[model samples]
Structure formats: structure tokens, C-alpha cells
Target: MKTDTVITKPLLEIDKSIDALVKQIELLSFVNPTNIEEEKARFFSSKYLTQPVFKYPDINFDRFKLHRKLFKQQIELIEDERIKNLYEDIIYTYSGLIKCIETIGSGKKFYYNSLHCFGTPTEIDVENAKYILHFEDEDLDSQAFAPKYNAKEAESFFRAYSEQYDFTYHIKHSDKISAIAMVSNNAKTLVLNTNHVYSDNEIAVLTNHEIGVHMVTTMNGLLHPLKIFSHGFPNNEETQEGLAVFAEYMSNNLTVTRLKELAYRVIAVNSLSKGYSFSKTFRLLHNQYDLEKEAAYYITVRAHRGGGFTKDYLYLTGLKKVYDYYHANKNLSLLLTGKVSLEYADDIESLIEKGLAVPAKHITDAYAENSNTNKTVDFILKNLK
Candidate 1:
């Protein structure tokens, strides 16, 4: 049997306090609009010319109190400079998220706040998106790509896939979510869009994408001596999203179609930087790029919702970074040590040495072997600018 690592008393207390405060501020809870389906209907009924009027859930916590409590932690008592610096950064990151939540739907205010938190895509990132768009998409009419499974069936598929690991998480259906599926880190639940019909390949794709890396990290983060791993490291979204998409690649489910979806996200987010409204971005994807209407609308909503969220653009950049890291034979397991960033591998190692962190309790099963057979997809990833 394994023994628990002993973390210092002061550090543990501060970590627990911060964790308690941070638990209430899950950004997804506030950012995902509560009226997605309604807004989508209105958008389509208006012949795709109207901007969506999104409604977000109210902030349930006292933001000022949360901020004060987070900053009042005795971080100075932590003797380790690296650990202290990390805690400070985490506090500021959480504060920034609070500001983001506060400014949602306030036009440029929220966009500027989002820019500070999740930056806009660079010129090279935009070029890479266009490069992927140049490739021919695979046949959508193929038997393997048929949409057959409903939300309940997808839940069953996910539950069965998750049986290989020793973790348990709730699966729920929602009409409000922007994606067909997403994992709630704090809630330990998978939220599936009630209206989506799943393809066999997409089931496999999401199984690895959501459960393989995301829920694996969620469970592993809980096993750590410090709660920061559970909350997240600063700027951890890019790494988390990259690992999830990489899981799809490793499992042989990543297709040119999927890559194009990510590429479209980059294009849509870049449109936000250019001040494109929802209809304009939708036209760029639908009319210019010939993406299907519903597909284009969701991508537009993802970018334009919350007044120009740029986080979607990170998925492609993150995939490129992780793909290179894997080829370089770096320690991918370290990145799996709970909502962590690649830049903080050294800090995670230091935490382990100090008995404040542990190796991931559950590893992404896809990482065990490379099953990808799509050479075209490989060529595209390798050639991304």
C-alpha cells in the first residue's frame, strides 16, 4: 500500500483555504450562457443576421470577500521561494478570473479582460489555421461517421470507457453548453449537449478527449498534498486542452475533419480580434469557408460569447506544443500531475521533492501507445506554421 506524503503545516492550511475559496469561482459556471439554445434559435430565425443575446448565470458568491480572503493567506510563511511565487501567481490568476466573470456581457470590457486572461491568437497561429483549412476534408457520409448515439447513449459509452480507470464521475445532459460535451473539473461531472447526435468516431474522440486526459487530471489533482493542483496552475487551460486533443490523436480517432474544426476555432477567434460581430464571423465560416450553418454558428458563438472569448484559439497552439513535446521525448507524465502547465514541470518536480505533490494517480490510457494511422493528419500537424 502507498503512504501519504507529508506537506508542511502552514503550506497545507493556506492551500486548503485557497482551495475552498477557489472552488466557488469555477469560470465555466459563469461563462457558459444559460440561454444558448434560445439565442441560437433567434440567431437562425433572423436568417443568421442577429447577434446572440446571451444570458449568464448570476454570480452567487461575494467577489470582494473572496478576493480579500485569497490575498490574506499567509503565503509569506511558506519558506520555499518557488512555492511561494506559485501561490502568489495562482491568487492573481483567480483574481483575474473573478474580474472576467464580473465583466461578462459588458462588451469591450469583458473582451479586454478575456484578452488579459486568455490572449488572442498570433499571426503565425492565424496562418497555421489557414494552412489546415487548405486541406481536403474526409468523407462525412462514410459509415463510420454516421451520427447515431443520443446523449444518454453517449453517457453509456463514456461510462464504459471510463471503467478501465478507477475513477467515478457524474454525466449529465444540458442544453446550455456550447460544446457537444465538456468536463466540469470542480464538479467531477461530464456535461453533454442534449441535442447532439454522436458519431462512432466522435464517441471515441470524446472518450479520450474528455475522460482520458481531463478527468484523469481531475482525479490525479485530488491525490496531491497541495490543492493548487486541483484548482490549477497559472495558464493551465492551454496545456489541459492540448493534452485532451492529443489523446484523440494517440487513439487514432483524430481526423482531418477534427483538425479543421480546431482550425476553424482559430479563425473564429482571430475574427474576434478584427472586431467581427457574431453574424460576420458566422459568414466568414459559412459563406467564405463553407462550413455547415449549425457548425459555423456554434464556433461563432464560442468566440463571440462573453464578449469575445479568445480561449478557443489556444486548442490548436496547445496541440502543436504537446505534439512537439511528445516527439522530443520529454516527461509527459509530469504534465499530467494535475491541471499543470509545461512551463512548470520543474516546479512540479520541486513540489514532489518537498513531498507536496505526487505522480498522477491515473494516466491517460491513450498515451500508452500511438495508434494514429492518418498520415495526412500527421503531415498537417508537422507542417503547422
Candidate 2:
């Protein structure tokens, strides 16, 4: 006697499967810091395990093909043009995610990952880029005061931050490198690989950049309603890194030297893509660019670490792009959430405005801010737009 609903059972099944797949993959973390040789060995040596493959409709290389696809699938589902447009604008971001994976697999190279982004178009640019690092004697002197990557410092920072935020976090340390931070739902962790090697200036920048900005955004995204918050949009690092550096600027910690350091990173990374060896790249930075040995070594190692790869250039390059975007009066809030880029900001904001940008179901602790967030936001708004 009752009329049937417009939605049928088959449609319901697809939704259920999507939900299940999302659940299965949501919390998985893949952390591979191995060099290119190791990654190559692992990739080829792995036995061909049975895997399900689905051929989505082939995406054309036409301009905005990704935008069209998102409109048909991801964007249309949202039911709000404002939010839909935001998603549409950022469809190309996935290219960065893909590029990151590709660069890791192939050698150093850059390319136009999206309509708004450009970099090395061939494999050779990785080795042709240049790099230089500059620091004063006082900066070197301050290096002795920097925190060591031992359990003591790790436990201290983790405990202090945990107490402030009321959530548990972990730490990872490596003697050979500086530091890296990894964030996921309900947890934050720092990897102090080169804690022994970084100067005080670098340490301050790293701590605030990684813990304050990266970790804070991860926890914030976790508080959103969608799981996508934690996964981050494509090419999210550009905005995130820029915001981190911006945060440094906001905190009165930004320096021209830091900016130059990132520029050098891009140059060094560009060189690695061209197959430059560590020593050769070192000379380029030292002799050609007139950088100190220590500085050149840092740049060289970044390129050499992943089998003569230069993906690290994106950090600096991404920061500059994001900064420019901010000044151009673009949406900058989404970046406050996670490793997303400025390119996706308008899209995310549109979604938020339309109520589609709901909070995630779970979140870690929020860091205690000694100052008002509005002050920083206002400062950024004035400088940016």
C-alpha cells in the first residue's frame, strides 16, 4: 500500500561498499623513508599478489578533465554550487599526491602537476638545480643549545605538549637528519632524525613549523565531519608548509635567510633530478653558489637521501606559491586544518560555507596558544590580502 522511495536497493549497495572501503583504508599509514634503491628493490621484489582492479572511465588530458570528473562524482554529491566549485577548483591537487609518489619511484624531476603549478618537466632538472645555505657565527654558536634527539628531549616535548593538549603522542629520532613530524587522527608524533645536526634557528623553526602548525592542523582536521580532513587534499603540502613558515613570520621568527634556505632547497632538489652525485651537487652549492660546506652538505644530503631525488624542493616552492596565493586574496583557512595547499582553499571554504565542511568524528588534543588566534589571523590578513 506504501509508495516506494526514490532511492533503490542497488544504489544503497554502492553507498555501503564505499563506506566500507573508506573505513578499511582510513587509518592506514604508510611511512617509507627509504632511499630510491631500497624502494625500487621493494617494489620489484614484492610477489604479484592478487589485487582487485577497477577501470574508471579514462580521464582525458584535456584542460579541466579532473574538474569535470569531480563535478560528475565528488562535487555533485555535495548539492551546493559554492562548495562544489571549491572542490572543482582543487581537483588538480591530487596531481601533487601522485607526483610525490611518482618522484619517489622515478628519479628527480619536476612537472606541471596541475594547471596552477609548474616545475621540472623532465628527469634531468633534478640534477641541474643549485642550492646555498647561509648562517652567521652566532647562529652556529646557538646550535650547541639546540635539543638533542634523545629520549630526554623527545619525552620532555611530548609530555609537555601532551599535557597542554591532553592527548598522547609519540617521538621518533634519527641521528643523521633534522626532524620530521607525522600526524594522524588521535595522535601526533615527531621524528628527530637530524636533531644533532640542526642549529638553534633551525630547531625553533622546525618545532613551531612541525608541532605548532602541522600537528595542530592534523588535530583540527580530525575534528571535522569528513574523513578527508585527515587524508588531506592533493598537493596540500604547499599551503601547509607556507602556513608553517607564515606562522614563523607571525611569531616574529621568519628571516630572509630562511627564505633563501628554502630557495636553495629547490635548487638543490632540481639538481638531483639531473643525476648529480652528492659530491658534485656539493661542489655546485659550495663553489658555484658560494655556500658553506655544512650548508651545502645539508642540501646535498636532501637530494642524495632518496637516491639522488629532489622532491624536497617542493617545500620551498610550495611555500612561495601558497604565500603568493594568500596575497592574491585567496581562502587561507583550509590550510589551518592539515597538509592542504592554497589551490584547494577556495574549494574547501565553499564547502564549509555550505555546511558541507562538517567536522570529523574524532580528534586529538589542541595545542595551547599563548596568544590569540585572531591576532595572528588578522596579522596575516593584513599582510596577505
Candidate 3:
């Protein structure tokens, strides 16, 4: 006997309501604290001699609490166990996000959410950064370090790639971000840092990382029956970033400098867990390790922002997991099913089988071609512990 499961009308209404509420909670838009520009100026004005003092943006905890109440109420009303678990996962992710917003500027409180949201760097993570630190690259040689394009040039190059996919998005300049793809329910915008110098090849790498995966996933998620796919699953950061970096590799643009940047992020993030202050982390990278003052400052600001951010360490970790999984011949389609988690690939399969989700509308063109021909890069990415 075949029993057909019916989705009730009330469930439909609840899904729509939850989607609207989640859209209202713009995590990234709110997470970049307003004081970054001020602090960056302060740090530079002191000629890298003084610690940065950051001012956090105000978050309305009262509104967030009320929304959480409504989220809990909605979750309680869900009849399907699998769907209920998904909703619960979203609520937990939201709670962590709220904690991150509330704890900004406070060292202890922000570290709590940083642990919950991104996790502390493990001993393995610490060792990986140390190992990568000693790497000598010819690419770092001055004769090979010509950055021909600035942000405007980089943005123009990105536009060509974006046009190929018929992706309509906006480019915005920011003093804070070092080129980020911002995807929300209603907008797709890439924020480029005017302070960072970009090369032609760097834009290609960013094209693959930001637009190829992030923006493609954004458009794909919009075609889904549920909105959670668009917003990202719990801990979607790891897999999404891994996939993006993989795209960079597939397109033959992943460089040793990029890998070193990821390594530096791990070291800086670990410094936070070890109770290092902003100046302490900066000195460790700049004075002790001899990283360029500009690059060192960029790395320090990321980990020390909001007192103790640990999110940057996940890039290397994510690269390892996604590459290992791909090397095993698992279907990439499962990963491209919108902003998803590798942990929940099975759940995504179940959702597709149940007709709750569809196959990706726009697969990344970068991944469609096998162009990563660098063996040394492959060896390092594959062998990372």
C-alpha cells in the first residue's frame, strides 16, 4: 500500500512566515561593525605601533529575542520530524548569530559565539599554520609581485564573468572587506576593499571564489521550495567556503599566496584562543614572523575583530574536507544544492526525493571544467593535516 503524505495548508503559511522573518535577520549586513574604518585609521595613524580600538555597531537584542520566540513557536507547530529538525538547526544558527552581534567589542562574550559559530582552532590547526609559515615561494619574490589592476579594474574583470552566467549583481566598494560576496534574500552584491591591491590573476581567483560558487549558489537557492537553502544551513560556512576555494583551484587560479593567507588566518585565530590581544597578534605576524605590515594588519584585523573572531581558520579546514570528499568520487551535485552543509548531504538527498527541493538551477561553470593542473598545489591541499 502506498500512502501519500500531504503537506497541510498551515505548514505552507508557516514556511512563508519563517522565511520572511529569517530574511529580516540580515547577519552579514549587521555583523560588519561600523567602527572598522575608524579603527583601521587609528592603527595606521600610529604607524602600526598602537593597538586598534574598535567600536561595535548596536544590535537590537529585544527584537532578536522576540523573533526567536516566534521561531520556537513555529518549530513547535511543525509536524514532520525531519523538517522540524531543520527548523531547529536554523534557530540554533540564529541564536549563535545573535550572540555574535551582542558580544562585539567585548572580548569574552564574542569568543563564546565565535566558539559556537566557527569553533576554536585545534592543535592540528595550529600545527598546519606553523608548517605553512615556513614555506618559501618564488611567487613572493619582488620581480613576480606586480599587481596591475586595482579594485575598479578587478570589478570590471568580475563583470565579464558575471555576464557569462546571466547573473545580475551589483558591485560596492568598502573600506572594511577584502572582497566579499554578499548574498541576501533580495540582493546579490560583492563588496571590494579599496585599501587592498588586486592583481589580474587575483581577480580571476576572486571571480571563481565569490561569483562562481557563492553567487551561483545564491541564484540556485532562490529556485528552491524552501528559503533555508538560500540563507544557509547550520555551519554552512565550512562547506560553502571549501566549495568556493575548490572553484578557485578548478579554475587554475588558487595560488600559494592565497594558501598562505589561509594559513596566516589560522595562526591569528589561534592567537585569540590563546588570549592574545590585537597588538599581540599583530606583532606576532608582523614583527616576529616578518609578514608585510599591510598583509599582517589585514590578517590581524580579521581574527581580532569583535575581540576574538575565529571564523577565518575554517578556510583551510574546509578546503581539506571538501577536497578529500571530492577525491572519493562523491557526487558534486549534492554539494551544489544551494548553501548546504557537507554534514547534511544525506538530508538534502532526502529533501530532493520528497520533492521539497530541486536540483541546482545554476551550476558553477568553473567546476564544470577540469583545469587545475598544478601538482604542487594539489599535493599541499591533499596532504594538509
Candidate 2 lDDT over residue span 138-231, tens digit each: 2434444464554445445544544545334577664423224343433456665433444445555665666667776776665544445655
Highest-TM-score candidate: 1
Quote each prediction's TM-score.
Answer: 0.96, 0.60, 0.91
User: Which structure among the candidates has the greatest lDDT?
Assistant: 1
Candidates 2 and 3 compared by lDDT, better number: 3
Tens-digit lDDT track for model 3 on 308-374? 8788898889888888888898877788888899999988887777777888777788878779877
Q: What is the C-alpha lDDT of each candidate?
A: 0.90, 0.47, 0.76
Q: Lowest-lDDT window of 10 residues in candidate 2?
A: 48-57
Give residue 333's lDDT in candidate 3 (0 to 100). Answer: 75
Model 3 stretches with alpha carbons more than 4 Å out: 1-5, 8-11, 35-38, 44-49, 58-64, 140-145, 178-186
Better of 1 and 3 by lDDT: 1
Q: What is the lDDT for 235 in model 1?
A: 89
Q: Give, for candidate 3, the lowest lDDT window spanning 10 residues.
A: 1-10
TM-score ranking, best first: 1, 3, 2
The deviation in Å at residue 269 for candidate 1 is: 0.9
